[model samples]
Target: MTLNRRAFIGTGVAAAAALRAPMVWSQGRPRVVVVGGGAGGATVARYLAKDSQGQIDVTLVEPTRHYYTCFFSNLYIGGFRDIASIGHSYGKLAAEYGINVVHDWAVGVDRDAKTVTLAGGAVLPYDRLVLSPGIDFVDGSVPGWDVTVQNKMPHAYKAGSQSELLKAQIEAMPQGGRFAMVAPPNPYRCPPGPYERISMVAHLLTQVNPTAKILLVDPKDKYSKQALFEEGWAKHYPGMVERIGPDFGGDKVEVRADAMEVVIDGTVEKVDVCNVIPGQKAGRICEMAGITDGNWAPVTGYTMQSRIDGTIYVLGDATAQGDMPKSGYSANSQAKVAAMAIRGELLGSSVFPAKFSNTCWSLIAPEDGVKVGAAYEPTDEKIASVSSFVSQTGEDAALRKQTYEESLGWYAGITSDMFG
Candidate 1:
């Protein structure tokens, strides 16, 4: 979210006391309602309730009993991690953090009324609202492909049973079989997600079916950490993977679920496995709240508050913030900022200068990883990058291994930050 200046936005001395109105319940404490318990929502809710002690009434509205993170899901697909390792429960947030974790979909957001309508038939009032619903695919981004036929050509973007389905399809592939991936375009969740998934698939195929071929149908001419990934693919996987860019009919592609075929450049090919990741936008909840600019929620980077409605904040993949990619780390970082601002407004808490940082690490092969990250600050326009670093194309093995270990540590740290 862009503001007049990328700076910490306080409700100010005058507005802070007056901020509490019909938004607060008669119970006593100021209430904060968080939607979509992923990286952003979970972290915000936990921090608000934990730091505020018993002052702030925090409620997290989530639909799943267990959340399967999309961050380490590639490791699950590559056999480096198990599904249970990436899955987390909200029990800790409820019992330990004292957050009222409600397992139900937030069906509608009444910004004017400052209430969230849940599918389970409850109206939740909030002094502030945080929405971090993640991403939803764009219809017709890949022709003949939608949620209806998600089984035949699995996207596995949401990281649940879809991930299991894709892995099963990969294991079922015959030796020397063809595997096709329909990659998404730019500005999608996790800029490096599709490529990391390809790396994982290649890792699995090398072990199970070394002779198998991977077809990457990519709309972009290049992608995040392209050099590092391509080098690793050539060194480790050899000629097993081939890429089709937009210049070479990557964009002109379609899938046929009924025929089990893929058409690239008008050439029909029958593949044993298909992983179709279509173009993505913000999750449906943002659009339903009428706070989205077509694809993402515009917010004030200073506080992560919605530009359309200051009382509401947006985070993670659903927000169109500056510089940072749609990463779990970025969302977690933004959540802390929003949590501080919301507390400052509600509880007269100390407000520090807002600053944000993010790092996205990706694994290419066993003990081989690459990363791209930056420190960011608010500009009058958006959150802009300050200093950044990335893995070199031909890094030493020890450094790569260190990077891989760093990613594992980050996974543990961030999940703990969100859940605990």
Candidate 2:
């Protein structure tokens, strides 16, 4: 579907006017404070800034100056794409969209007072708040795993420093060195990410060090697009990639980076490099705001508003949206819905019924890509499946190439939609 810039701006103006009559309109614009400038938060901030036309003041709080997506990060490791190609700047959001980009961490939240406190002891009041802080690692989920040992074994899940660390390790490994990966549990960001990472890294090893081997330690026996990934690995990497599932001795894996050894079952193995993707939970801000239950923030599916707080809405990987996977595409789609919902509520207009769509692409090789997508609608209290799509299995060679091209186009388009 084509993006309607004019219609979007028109909707925003009408919503703002409806919220406050011209006679009662104050000199100051309504304040909207957003935390996390990732996929979800960036989209919301851009749309609101573009549409509101100075009627709304948007303040985005994020510590990063640039965002590097995890989707195509494996390409960087494979030396097929440069890191700059996948990185985006917040300059457009600030200069063009009129968003105030604050480079600071959100330390606390006062829900009753509608104020957010930063690490520097400054409190910013907001008429509305949007949070998409992404995911944080779950402590003790994997024994002997924490931030202290992260340098020895990087997660690379957040797609910046860790990603660079992993790439450097791969390049420094000697010929015939072993590369091991520990996959996270199900329902993590990007369901097919771990397998795709293995594919790209294996591809790199085959060219640079053909004798090198890869060990995949997975907690689950099944995974998203398992059959397709396995087919590609077998066809391209052959025995170079060995996958061990839970039923097949994968559950007994243990790591000791200080000792430079990993134990699988009864055997202690040494590896030249290791990449561990850990299980995740909601960011700390969600917990501080009292919106999280366990590791996720519960939200109303229709509005993406927190179940515990009316003025606050949570989206992205940090929120529990039932069946929707915590993916960038999903987060972007959900942010638009939440933006519309907030507009409706503040403006006293009829809320539009929410419909969401997501398309996630995984690269199996430099020129080959596989994608899985779904269209969703709110059913009862949570999101329900409307339709789903996946790339054809054993398809023509040209189709795979086309999918790769499409993935690149999507990346460009989505980035533009978010920051441009």
Candidate 3:
């Protein structure tokens, strides 16, 4: 209920005889195949099955049994949360909702045949396809970095073992050592993620290696919650964090994973630990579906349907929806709208106007939280923002603590919404 402005579940019984004849349920019943089990795919799968009762068949195709959310992995890295706390399982979505959850990889999509090919060679026929496979890194965006070298300079972007790897590496750093972070380019998932990671790293270093220094090699001049983060850094841990922007060779950077060196402005420096978050694109499944326009899938603002293929809807970080940041909350919101539209098409359910809302909260230090959010609706061309709000600079302790507490509640609520 707390996220009701962004999520809605509709139910109504109207005789198909009174409405459009084409919308009547077929005898065999329509089948919906959802690829990926992140916020978007999971929420839509649950809603479509639960709201429709037994009117349709829902199958969720996801490779992972337990999903670790990328949203709060930074907090886990910071030691505020344990790894088990952020992990969720798909058992509830299967048993409780009567969904056919398939633990397999969706290798190919046959658009003409309306079927999906799984890794196990089973073919699933679907009336509607929902793809929300999340993000994949652009090849060679970080010089001298690839999947082969991820263990050395882990991105820790995907959560789980990578996050634990990064945490152990950071803790193993020597006293007064240098830790470097090569931030990603614009239009990446979780705009505030890297900065939050920095805050968490700082929080850990302040207690362990008080003399350690953190150097951020950032392409962007400014980051989300810039003023507030800077204020907290200066107040809590001064002289420990430094940012090198593009103007000072932040954009011109490279890494040598084998040698553990970072090249900034043609100057190579040895580092104790390196975190290279590469530029991202839509997940590989999107490309396989032949719906991606460049690195992302272009979608209509009103409904998350692919502009290239109307029968297939794309959601979350994989979509190129205007103005909406590729966050878990945004994906969940988009899934509801797409679910409503899909239900209306197959089950003759009533459709409502599409609306979405999102909020991204970050912790600078313990009990010190900051946020930015907006409510949006479809425009002629994009998902335009109607209104926005952000945490003010130099806020009192009480409000910041309250915000952090609210974020904890949200994390609990959202994971339940997605998994259960």
Candidate 4:
């Protein structure tokens, strides 16, 4: 039967009543294992621990102790913020919220056994498994780029080390040198991310090497905030940024990381640095769990539960939820909904209708920001956008600065929400 909000809540209430007491007392509180530690996983872990009041045993699995946010990594590259600013520690989740934060790679998930195998030779048993492992690059999406040659091409899409490497490369570029970016196609993590990185790269190059040029080799015909970015590029860094679309064979391309050259439509162009943002799919762990439909894990938006297995939930960039973009803000929003639904099912708590919202902010230049956002509600089919807004092309400077300031506030608020 199709599980809509009412049916889900009704069944949950009945099952929770019968199973809650035995599960809690006999099993020593229902165990919840959350894999991943970024915006979605971290937020869900924190919320489950915070709201459950010790009735749930929450454990978070992540490989990195210091989680680097992909959302604002561009600003770090542009020198608006430092790398440390974008990095967050899982200490608060352990210390403050009483979550068992395991710093280990989750290698496998056994759904039948309800156990997760870690790389360090430990297994975790869970009553509910939340897989929010985020995105992993699709193999050979970019013809000549992979993790082995990442040091040379440097996707820098994951933030932290890659961001530092890309920034260092931009700084070390000789005068009038060329920088190339092979942008990913649609349905990748962070729709506006590549464009924002382009703007930030231009910002940095304009300051250090004014004569340097940027080539955006994009497979998409258009990108998020195209007009705003185009206008800003012309006004702030004129004749510096150039974009090649599919019409011009931008989609037909390959890179030579060894030679630092890009081959576009049989035309080889030498570049000083190449940033290859490749096509992406849900994190590998999702596939290992046998929960993915194609590249993404399909979930019921009403509760973020995997369509294949009701015991498993997926969130963030790894999910195939409709309408919402694969962004940090979107992930954070989805996490809350999942947390609420899980609590209702496990603890017999009240279940409320699911709602979600997201806002994507892009900085074109210093204090020049544009935004797009929407409110969403879960339908039988998907999470549908109910209302939306976007910054106009010719917005005033004061307004743009206000938008930028707003983004800073959101970053602080979200990081606190996720970590604490």
Q: Top lDDT: which candidate number? A: 4
What are the per-residue Cα lDDT tens digits for candidate 1 across 1-420?
111111222211122222233234477888899998999999899888877776899999999999999999999999999899999999999999899999999889888888999998899998889999999999999998999999999999999899999999999999999999999988898988898899999999989998999999999989999998899999989998999999989989999987878899899989999999999999898998999999889987888988899889999999988888999888988998898899888877777667788878898999998899898887767988989998898889998988888787777778888897
Which is superior by lDDT, 1 or 2? 1
Off by over 4 Å in 4: 1-25
| RMSD to the hidden true structure, all candidates | 5.5, 3.2, 3.1, 5.8
- lDDT-better candidate, 3 vs 4: 4
For model 2, the stretches where C-alpha displacement exceeds 4 angstroms are 1-27
Question: Model 1: residues >4 Å from true position, as ranges?
Answer: 1-27
Candidate 3 per-residue C-alpha lDDT over 135-156 given as tens digits, one digit per residue, 9 for 90 to 100: 9999988888998999999999
**Residue 148 lDDT in candidate 3:** 95
Q: Give lDDT per model, in order.
A: 0.87, 0.82, 0.88, 0.90
- Candidate 3 accuracy as lDDT: 0.88
Query: lDDT by residue for model 4 over 1-420, one digit each (tens)?
Result: 222333322221122212143234477789999999998999999888887877889999999989999999999999899999999999989999999999999999999999999999999999999999989999999899899999999999898899999999999999999999999988899899999999999999989999999999999988888888899999899999989999999999999988999999989999999999999999999999999987999999999999999999999999998999999988888888898888878887766778888889999999999898898988889999999999998889999988898788778778877887
Enumerate clash totals for all models, in the order shown.
2, 0, 0, 0
lDDT of 2 by residue, 1-420 (tens): 222343222221223323443222263767889999988999989877765566678899998898898778888878788888889989999999889999899999999899999997879899889999998998876676788898998899989888889988987889999999989986688888899899889888887888999989888879988888988988888889888888866777778888757677757879989888888889889999999988899988888999989899998898887778889888888888887776665544345678788777888876878888888888657887789988877987788888887777777767777788
Candidates 1 and 3, the one with greater TM-score: 3
Following a full C-alpha superposition, what root-mean-square deviation does model 2 have from the true structure?
3.2
Q: Write down the worst ten-residue block by lDDT for model 4.
A: 10-19
**CA shift of 396, model 1, Å:** 1.0
